[model samples]
Target: MGNSSFFFFVFCFIFLLVLGTCDCLSDQEKDRIDQLPGQPSNVDFEQYSGYVTVNEEAGRALFYWLTESPANRDPKSRPLLLWLNGGPGCSSVAYGAAEEIGPLHINSDGRTLFSNPYSWNKLANLLFLESPAGVGYSYSNTTSDLYTFGDAKTAEDSYAFLVNWFERFPQYKHRDFYISGESYAGHYVPQLSQLIYERNKGVKNPVINFKGFMVGNAVTDDYNDYVGTFEYWWTHGLISDSTYKSLQKTCEGSSSEHPPVECIRALNTAEMEQGRIDPYSIYTRPCSYTTSLKRRGRYPWMRGAYDPCTENYSNQYFNLPEVQKAFHANITKLSYPWQTCSDIVGGYWTDSPLSMLPIYKELIAAGLRVWVFSGDTDSVVPLTATRYSIDALNLSTIANWYPWYDNGKVGGWSQIYDGLTFVTVTGAGHEVPLHRPRQAFILFRSFLENKAMERSSISI
Candidate 1:
């Protein structure tokens, strides 16, 4: 049984090993994008967009788009950064991918694309997910699932998506990973971070090497947000003294999600006083008269932008048959058109913790890198509100408030606390990258490098 038998066994083992490796690679290749319908011909990065079924029984699947770093960037050495956009019902693909930090941007014609020079993928492998079936191209077999979605369910589904996604792209399974998002994602980024952190307990080097998370213009503590928002409105001269006082009396201690009748009335009065302005970015011109009107009724608290009709372009581009086919999306041929944010999901949101402050405390104690950033001009989730929420944490300051520079100019102000870093992008809106891509790029680099923002006049 000597030489012949041993050599035969070794050859079979080698054959099986190579076969298994090929099979795994083929599974990943199924999701690869040969090219997008309107993508630039000169693109040098590998892009993949497809669905990963997270719940077979519920027929729930989440859609994801992964844009690897450009060829010269040494993508293997880069961290995998997952970007989410929070509406409880928004598409990260729409807000984060297309308009914010993704490599390709949709042009006004909705049938062409342009390169985003400051795309985050220039420094990291970027993954944008449209979570919680029923948003973007993601869907659930049961229609009712659309209306019952909430924070907890969204986080659970996203975690599941990540697990399954890693199986498809096993190469990234053990890569350093970070999650970042804006707006309601303030709730999402931390909640998911805590889940990953808790689940990995006692396990040796889990597949998900979740290192940290960052959120911009996020919704944190309700009480602090309420106080800070009212103060912002007053200080920014966007509300009357009477309306501000009314808001304070009625809104204090009230849940922003489910405010009392008096609070609702006060909010309505405040809106009237504030008038026809883009509440999201008070400093920028509204997208258009018609677009602003269309958005006003639906997203009173959270939409619009400085780029004006960027959302409209995303909506138009994503709904195209060719674009959907290119993205491997809308295969089910859903009855409705793709929207930037899902009204059904957002309107019928079932549950949200009144505060994310506890989660922050928990993660901070766990020694996860946490950063909270705000676009100083975003009235929707303004800098003042973020400041108020951070103040409530009572962590020891590592670096006192300092002006962080970008290209010899004050990009923003930053403060490094015991376990959290708070940053403000000076002229940005709720979607910082869209409004200020260069500064946002610098901010992202700093976050990933775990370095303080540049204090010198020279840019990195």
Candidate 2:
């Protein structure tokens, strides 16, 4: 530990300086965090209007969606946005509800909402969905109900979720819809979007009306996300100069080359976990965070890193009996763990299996719009990775690549391709909303207002 003190100090210093004025954590840590004062468990989540089950006759499967009504939402809405949590194994209820965007951002106090006026619900009626069954509140009564955890199965079930979910909320049927997610969603959003486009081509009934999609700091490609991230850490000075140089030489040279890939993967993952934080801010990173927020950058946008699965988020989530009960729900007996990470070999996604590129291409060909945005400082799924993945498509044209300014600083960059656009939300890390809510709100509104997704009528 002493040998690494210099790097650690530098990391701490940077985090403190960047987030010197963080407002989330308290000046008070000892004031008895609001514990769950022992209320009878109301895990009767099945009764809530927000939860709509999908039961197909072919299989006695049970899946659920938490639907927040657009009518109850602010009138500023435009479309019904479906958000899927990634991890290929994680639950959207955990991340989408408790952390990033929902009705609230629970403070350490546990009983309050730092009411996220910036919640995506502020713009579009938000749907936090758990899909492929056996995830979150979704379940399979029969063995066959669980779709094989793969790109194709995920897309099928997700598209099915939309088709059936619309049956319950008929109002949103004809209204425009958008698909979005992060991490493993690189496979989800695109594949599901393709399902919508393909099925809608000849149909008198189209459940997922074509609209734009959004992804942030996503895992869209294997080679790019894994390889490109190391370069980012080195360029940003998070990794030691020697380590970075050594990585470039040893790891950069291999792809199919085994034994060395895991080393490269770890080195790159370090850069992602190290987010922005200010040392002097008094708001510390989580106990298990491999690096400090100060060391990496608590990502100025999200502001802290407590492993989402830990009791640190208990008050934020499990404080409610419904959440607590769900955590212990008999999932593993059904062959899936209530997991935040995969412990099994080959876990879930063995490849950088991204989904949206095909969906984007389908949408572009059909004249629908598509966009992908990232928080510039996020090492989680850095911007270069997105770029390299999209390059796989060999998009034929380019339009604008310019700095997007906020508060007179280069907040990030925005670029337009033939049919898709990518933007970097400057100064932000992963979970763009938690980190840069205002900017994320602005980006979402741009898509809703039909300005950002609209292509110039003039053709070259």
Candidate 3:
């Protein structure tokens, strides 16, 4: 054979060999992360981030980051925990996954990642979703989808994502599953769990071996949230007595989601009185960029190591083309930049309920384990609000409230109700795990074990 012809034949043979080897693994297995941008070397656990198409005709897809349990190599025994973040338009990948509980956090420089020793993935296979098809890298081909989004549709799309996601990773088809989220997720988590519960009813041997759900500082009841928030502000000495009384009088029986003009005026007065402190965590320093707090010559975005002002770094990291390519995200070349919170989605959110207590009651009555936790320092969804909402359930207290300890110190407080458990992480704000990692990890481990938190002072 001629030399050129022989070389062409050899190339063809090698090409087929490479193609065959590449196609050997299942699509799901192929999705296993080889490496993430700026990931630390010598990492042991596998991580996957990509899109799961929930709707084909509409070309709608949701983004997810799945981190395998670092401590447990065996997938069969570990549970799968799905986490969502409540912004009505927030990216769970940005906040919940990258910033709070995920294995790695983007460094302040926005080009590197650091290990979070206290990540929840040590106990469970953590999945962080950027849901509703308009948040983060998730997108919809149908332009109208962005404009018309709400609680019901978000729940529906999320369930579809799960069903399809199971097909992709069948090894986890029957893995014990739990859902957890915070803030507006007070609406998202329970609503999705209700859907899962209802769907799993008639089917024998369901794909998702659903277990229970937990929410932190959730917005369960509008009235209670407002009352509790205003009461908390007053009790914490963040607002004046006159402003507090005005808030109480004007906000009574009012919707926090869409408050009346008088209620808005009262809230305005209270906010003005509270000054530049972060509303999410009263004691913690606010993100200088987001807040008006004065910092001499300190750029708002130039946060230091492990700073809680992570939004800026997260945004910069996700927007990097190399980072996007590493995760196989943003395949469609999204029109907008990556945002921690999506203005498009948040602006269009509709059909918010006045209360999720009824849904909680339904889930509790169905024998599903339910837990609600709060970061005591969070003024936005304070412990008082969660307490008031849980009181509306009127569940008989099985265990009296007591301090739960970790490492010979009081981690927080907890109380067990008949079918629900309530926990408070001391000194933590809206994002419990971010602020109090050890305590949050302890609470998470106890919740997964279905064991009571340690009440007596003892090292974890």
Candidate 4:
């Protein structure tokens, strides 16, 4: 063959080979997902985990894990559910994804994962985020970001993360999206949802496709929360009469985080009276895996999960080098290990509003779906607290309170209102899914469907 003809043939051959290689990989493969260190073999869903830069100037990024529903639903049709854990400093990747609502649970050995049959991913495309640049695998190059975090900054950063994240995937740009969280997320979810709702107005068509939001055992109104909490403690026989009276007298109008000296003393007395009985769950046994409580000069408290041992296991699993590498996390190799909650952020949280009810009202007025749920056994942010906060909204009742069932037994009680809904899981604690996975899943499905909780459903 002539030299020119041979050279052209070789160039064509190289071009075809490169094109074929690109065609072989699907979008899921193109996106980063190194197989989990020890994932279950039978898993059939696609999973992606990585960082999205929310602020390039400050080197702040948020880590996220997205799990497509196992039912093999089309990504276009399935709604997106973004879940945040409270604490204002907690790792949603660790607690929400690994321990509670994600598709898998860490094995007791902390080296393997097992299927979570009642995972929320079965209902939608679930996303778990470690937010605010200091929690879990998310971080900031600027050290001040760790200690100067609060509601406004967290909400803003999370919204920016969403905008950048949609760019990364692109497929889910206009997909129906919902935000949910618990505890301090009572503040996080509502504030972020409000921002999404407002931002949607300025643009012709929002890429976010923002829908509604839900919070479980959330901190809503400070006054109502304090009142309901003190009442719950008294009614549950957790505190003495004098201590309860003292709380009522001293903590009525003061900030719960920084009450007066008399209120602090009363709270201390209440703490002493209640002893080490896991204020979060009230009934579950505390994790015995670590002596860290002794090191901190504090009593260990029960974890919110049904299997209290899972916390320690998850902690161990997340800190593993293989696991971190698989998830593409901890790339900076910081001085400390990955913790479920960040001491830096939690200790230095600067601003918490006296109430999130105003934000909730704005969202509801915008015709957005708002649902608030509570685990009846959670003393920290009990059902009573949620009810009182909702009562402040004065929303009209659409449906009377009724029992919702699963497995032929009452799963929880739910009441529907014109612009909102309230639910209480029968035996759940602060973290509903971790404590009552089956029941939590039922509530989750009904919420997504925009219908009343079913009286009965096939149990997982």
- Whole-model lDDT values for every prediction: 0.86, 0.56, 0.84, 0.83
Q: What TM-scores do the predictions have?
A: 0.93, 0.70, 0.91, 0.91
What ordering of candidates by TM-score runs from best to worst?
1, 3, 4, 2
Superpose all Cα atoms of candidate 1 onto the true structure and report the RMSD in Å to 1 decimal.
Answer: 5.1
Q: Rank order by lDDT, top first?
A: 1, 3, 4, 2
lDDT of 3: 0.84
Mark the regions of model 4 whose C-alpha exceeds 4 Å error after superposition: 1-31, 202-204, 289-307, 455-460
Among the numbered candidates, top lDDT falls to: 1
Model 2 root-mean-square deviation? 18.6
Runs in model 2 deviating more than 4 A are 1-77, 111-114, 142-148, 240-287, 290-311, 314-316, 322-359, 396-399, 407-409, 453-460
Output the better candidate (1/2) by TM-score.
Answer: 1
Clashes of each: 0, 21, 0, 1
lDDT (Cα, tens digit) per residue for candidate 2, span 330-400: 32244443533222311433333323455566678887777788777665567776887777777865767
- Candidate 1 on 1-460: residue-level lDDT in tens? 7999999999999999998887755657877888888788889999998989988998999999999999899998889999988777788998898889999999999888999999999999999998779888999998989988988999999999999999989889889999999888888898999999999999898999999999999988888888888898899998999999998999889777778888888888888788777777788777775565554342334432333688878888998898888888888889999988877887778888878999999999989999988898877778888898999989999999999887788999999999999889998988899889999999999898899988977554
Instruction: In angstroms, give how far residue 416 of model 1 lies from its true place.
Output: 0.8
Q: Best candidate per TM-score, number? A: 1
Model 4, residue 25: C-alpha shift (Å):
9.6
Candidate 1 residue runs with Cα over 4 Å from true position? 1-25, 289-307
Model 4 lDDT per residue over 1-460, tens place: 9999999999999999999887876544545675898898888888898788899999998889998887565655789999998776778887889888999889989999999989988889999999888988999999988988888999999999998888878888888999998888888899999999998997766899988999998989989998898899999999999899999999878885667888877877887898767666788776652353332222111112222667678789999998888887888887888987776877677888989999988988999989999999988888888888888999899899998878788888999988999989988888899889988988898889888887665554
**Ten-residue region with minimum lDDT total, candidate 3:** 296-305
